[model samples]
Target: MRKDWQNLAPAHGLNALVENGTIENLEVKDHVANILETNGVDLNDVEGVIWSHWHFDHTGDPSTFPSSTKLIVGPGFSEVFTPGYPADKNGHCLESDFAGRELQEIDFSGSDVTIGRFKAFDYFRDGSFYILDAPGHTIGHINALARTNASPNPGFIHLGGDSVHHAAEIRPSEYLPLPESIEPSPVPKLHSNACPGHIFAPVLKDGSKTEHILEWQDPWAEFVEPKFGLIYNEKDLRETVRKDEELDANRDIFTFIAHDWSLKGVVDEFPKSLNGWKNKGWKETTRWLYLRDFQAAVV
Candidate 1:
């Protein structure tokens, strides 16, 4: 229904999962600093940089930010990634990123607040933002739940950092089942505006029937294997995804993963706030857009 193919591309073209790539090829035209500057935001005003985990891709060129900007990380981050790069020799991060800045690690052991089975830390005290301990992808991996509004019917945006790579990992659950028919097919070049959901049945995991998109016992049935085998704890990651599915099912919450290609053109970009997502109908539009990735298999 929405004709915005300008941002639509094959899943591979939009995928951020890189393996054994050179820095030159991986370089992007705009970094966080560039985006902030474009929006008339000064780097000096940024008080803190929160890292979901110490992964190379997630930790952008932090050295660009002003030293006054504190670098916040999850628990066990210091124990492992501290004394970065040259000093540690085998560290994943560079010392320059933390040289003159204060690197603060989040310790959730004392926090009693819990949100959707996760140990939460109210970053702003005012329920507006919360940092959740979501481990599995790596040690001290965390996710964020941001309250978009304060009204009686408030909406939340769950920033799922590497909790799951694709929407298929957490979608089509008991709470959000696949529709019998999908309108405005995700395949960009398709002439038909609607796609039958049964086409994807052939690609479902073994023993999974078309009756349900994904079963509780096997949620990742339609997901692809990770390009890089960097999962720190597969078992814990499964549990984290299970909890994520619950949050995704909540009508008021929008679960957005770091690498979700479905949201490319659907959600508003930075400079445009995602505050009124519910009113804008962002969830309904983008929820099933990931189905486009299966175009090759289904066709």
Candidate 2:
């Protein structure tokens, strides 16, 4: 796009790429309706949709839905982003998404209900689902927590909207150690959770000027650097990660980083509730699967 490119929002940027033949045959889809139709579910009954934050990827094509369907977001969302796109010109969202719908922003500032370290609000008031105060990736970034099961031991599914990008972000730590063995699926099942080899990164001595600097190497795992770091608040983001990792450590909670592609074949998709995750052993089965991604990086 030239200087005259009026719309540069995430979706528009991507669409422009395709339209200009810079990218071809890319699938621009209405995934929301497709999933509902495939599952024999009615799309009209959708009361509303909750966006984890204001980022475009999470904020899908809400304009495709009926105007009666409300738009829900986390705290500070409206204050920071509203009167979207054409209305504000600098806005990243489309006004059509919330044009005639109710906008519900979850404000946990004065809430008394605290789940673990997060000030939480039960969306259903049934203690089964909650919106967590997650901040770091972006302002008003929030995560969801759902009680998966009840019985001898309760289980939870943590919907990490965008807190951690890679498994390495919260893995191989004191709480969750690398597995000695794993068994994946397909054919005889992807057994032997082995890697091509390990890579080591040298710990450079600080301010080393001479060749006499000596330091041992440490095993390296690269977690994709977070794009927007603490534009919201460093203290709040660090606190969020601290609590998030604690949740990752607990065996009862299965944290799903929304963008981790390694989970494609591991967990259940939409329309199908994730309530049986414990019985399915999803947390353990997909724990070491991320290593599959690094297989291609080896020479």
Candidate 3:
């Protein structure tokens, strides 16, 4: 989120989790600074802090904010957000102080809970600008969808939270570098001459199925390489199942993730905002140009 050196943690021993070249250490404050510069959105004005799950990068600088800020974390934020986590599994940065501010943990025990303005959040009604149910990344993993309502299609611009990392990961392209904790194997490109459509599901078809879209095993498929363990084998599967069931129940809601880098390109190509925020949603608009536009702007 914050693109500053100070925000990056010192590499001391994060080699266990990240691939080569990832920043190892950064401070809570430094990331806050980057958030301020890039998005121009005032952190002080952030009405709520919805941490999809408690990962270091996602929870970068939690303490910098005032305690009054309501923190929305998974039900098990306490258990997984601790020092023994795989990334911090070495017991190095396990100090509880890493969580800058006290958290208001929101547990979703397969039930609808009122968070903010929506009636039945997580899968009850049409989610507002900042919430969704996307578990699986963590036992308590979830997704948050935000929109300003100014766009012609507010339903189209959903913030997926961390359920997905980037757009390429979801698009018909090759798989991007996945986090080892989630997928342990390298993503294969199938075959050299294969079209991107080749990555879609249901490898075979017949008159039994019928039509241009024949027998799809998985419609929203991504070539996952679960690093922590197989999705069905892990102990966290129960929670994952509960969350997925809820998401499927309310599948009509349009949501997007919070940290997708490619989303800005889509945002830039088509920027819209709900009526609530002034100057459209560009309160912090500087860092959002398309890749070339951003490069040229800096040049």
Q: In terms of TM-score, which candidate is strongest?
A: 1
The 10-residue segment of model 2 with minimum total lDDT is 209-218
Query: All candidates' TM-scores?
Result: 0.82, 0.75, 0.48
In model 2, state the lDDT of residue 75.
78
Give model 3's TM-score versus the native structure.
0.48
Higher-ranked by lDDT: 1 or 3: 1
Best by lDDT: 1
lDDT of each model, Cα atoms only? Answer: 0.74, 0.65, 0.39
Over 1-299, each residue of candidate 3 has an lDDT whose tens digit, in order, gives 33332323332233433445555453345555355546566666765667666445565544455655556666555564454323474332234334455555554455565433222254324444435444556545656544445345433234445554433223221111112121111122322221232222232122111112211122213443332222312434333333422332232333344554433533443223433333443312211111221222222
Per-residue lDDT tens digits for candidate 1, residues 112-213, read 988899889999888988999888787789999999977788899999998888888886776666677777677656637777766777656552432223
**Comparing 2 and 3 on lDDT, the stronger one:** 2
Q: Candidate 2 clash total?
A: 1
Q: After superposition, how far is residue 23 of candidate 1 from its true place, in Å?
A: 8.7
Q: 227 in model 3: Cα distance from truth in Å? A: 11
lDDT sort, best first: 1, 2, 3
Q: Which segments of candidate 1 are over 4 A away from where they belong?
A: 1-24, 187-191, 207-229
